[model samples]
Target: MAIIKLSETKLQELKEVCKSFNNDKGELINVLHKAQSIFGYLPAEVQEVIAKELNVSVAHVYGVVTFYSFFTMTPKGEHPISVCLGTACYVRGAEKVLEEFRRILKIQVGQTTPDGKFSLSCLRCVGACGLAPVVMVGEKVYGRVSPDGVKDIVAEYRN
Candidate 1:
């Protein structure tokens, strides 16, 4: 695949992050965290630059990025929706709730809407068993979410 070119300014900004960490190879995780914060996601081009700066193989950088669930290659929408799928949530009907979200948004899990307003994902748990079948939008949690409540929840963020 061809490299996705970033603006000159973004490259400079990324360089500054590397410089801040003193380009220490051992600081790869820290650098990646900062880089992800700046770029929203760690795309291939960003990973390439990071590898070159830290003197590591691109494969190594890619490996670390993929190993960490927190890092993402694709950009998430403004309102990222995460549904809990842990045992408690599943037993509480998270699957139906998840399906409802997919239906209303017209995008399956791991996809963002075309308008970039919402992205859908499922996590093993959010540690809220009492609030089972929960949905989190950004940092806000909506507890006890039913399949019927999916439409209103999605509409809450619609512009």
Candidate 2:
């Protein structure tokens, strides 16, 4: 994946975001979130920039990014897919749906397709418990999905 370099304007904006927080330690996650929002993902250079601005160590920033499930070190696809694997969904065969996605896309969980069109991820739950076996593409929610439904769902975006 290509690294997204932060522009001066972006860096300045990040500084403003950083200022809204009280301290570096407390603001790590928020800063990273803002960085991800701007750059799509948290690259090493962006970490370095954040470290300099926040007066934190690059290692600390890297550590936080790696430790958090919400952080990504690589670019995400144009359309990101997250399958719910909570107990309710899992019991309803969400795992099977995830397996189907891997079979069709040839990429495991937490990976993006080489073409950069799709990325797959897993979530503990979407809080839509009534909608077990849910697959979310971007902001849209898809419920009651089956293993066979993966292909159609993927193809819908392609078309």
Candidate 3:
């Protein structure tokens, strides 16, 4: 898991987001989202806080975070790179592209760089099979990628 550094303002914001639910029982998931929004992923401390405020069990809250795809307990990189591994993308060489990213980044999927520059991950499909072998860096999408193109593609964001 990546370590999360939170500012006092952000911590207050998390509490505020949790408070908006107005109901301790129904606000669990909502608070989780707010926490994730502020921190990118929920750290253990955030989960503990939410559990204490909502009167929920820490195990229960942790379970929810672990079960949901949207929740990430680990800290993500500055730019999260998600590669598509859908059948179309796979046939188009998405695996090779992922390998290239791993090699260059020197980190496995779901990991952030020591410098906190990028995090690499994979998905089934970005729903853009026509652009098989697609990769998304944050909101921007790169399609029809090749293994050789990984470095250049990632480089565009470094600057």
Candidate 4:
């Protein structure tokens, strides 16, 4: 795969973050967190730089990244849309709601829109069974979402 090169300023900034962490290999997760915050996502090239700085194998870094569900290698859109797919949600027609989002957004789960305005993903549960079919855009949550309500929800973010 081709490397995504980092600019000089970004490279220097990432180095500073490592320096702040003392470059201890045990702080790999913390380093990765700061790196992701700086770069938006943890790409292969960034991971390579981190591995070298932290004095650990790239494989080890990759292992830790993949182990955590919160870590993502791809960039997310400004509005990250998530649909709940827990047992309660599934039973309450969340599948149809998810399909509507995919149909309208034209992107599959884990994919961001070409314009980088929105992303689609599925989560197991949000601990809101009372509102089983819950959809989240950023931190805001919409409960009892239905397929018909999808267009309005998508439109609200169009601007």
Model 4 segments beyond 4 Å from truth? 1-13
TM-score of each: 0.85, 0.86, 0.90, 0.83
Per-residue alpha-carbon lDDT of candidate 3 for residues 1-159, written as tens digits (9 for 90 to 100): 454566889888877877787638577888898888888888888898788778888999999999998899778888999999999999989999999999999999988889888999999988999998899999999999999999998898786
Where does the lowest 10-residue lDDT sum fall in candidate 2?
17-26
Indicate the TM-score of model 4: 0.83
lDDT score, candidate 2:
0.88
Error of 4 at 20 (Å): 3.2
Candidate 3 global Cα RMSD: 2.0
lDDT of each: 0.92, 0.88, 0.88, 0.92
Instruction: Tell me the number of clashing residue pairs for each predicted model.
Output: 0, 0, 0, 0
Q: Candidate 1: where are CA atoms >4 Å away?
A: 1-13
State how far residue 158 of model 4 sits from its true place (Å): 1.5
Residues 1-159 of candidate 1 have per-residue lDDT tens digits of: 567678788889998999888999899999999888887788899999999999999999999999998999987889999999999999999999999999999999988899989999999988888999889999999999999999999888996
Residue clash pairs of candidate 3: none
TM-score of 3: 0.90
Better of 2 and 4 by TM-score: 2
Off by over 4 Å in 2: 1-3, 7-9, 22-26
lDDT of 3 at 87: 98
* True-structure RMSD, every candidate: 2.2, 2.3, 2.0, 2.4
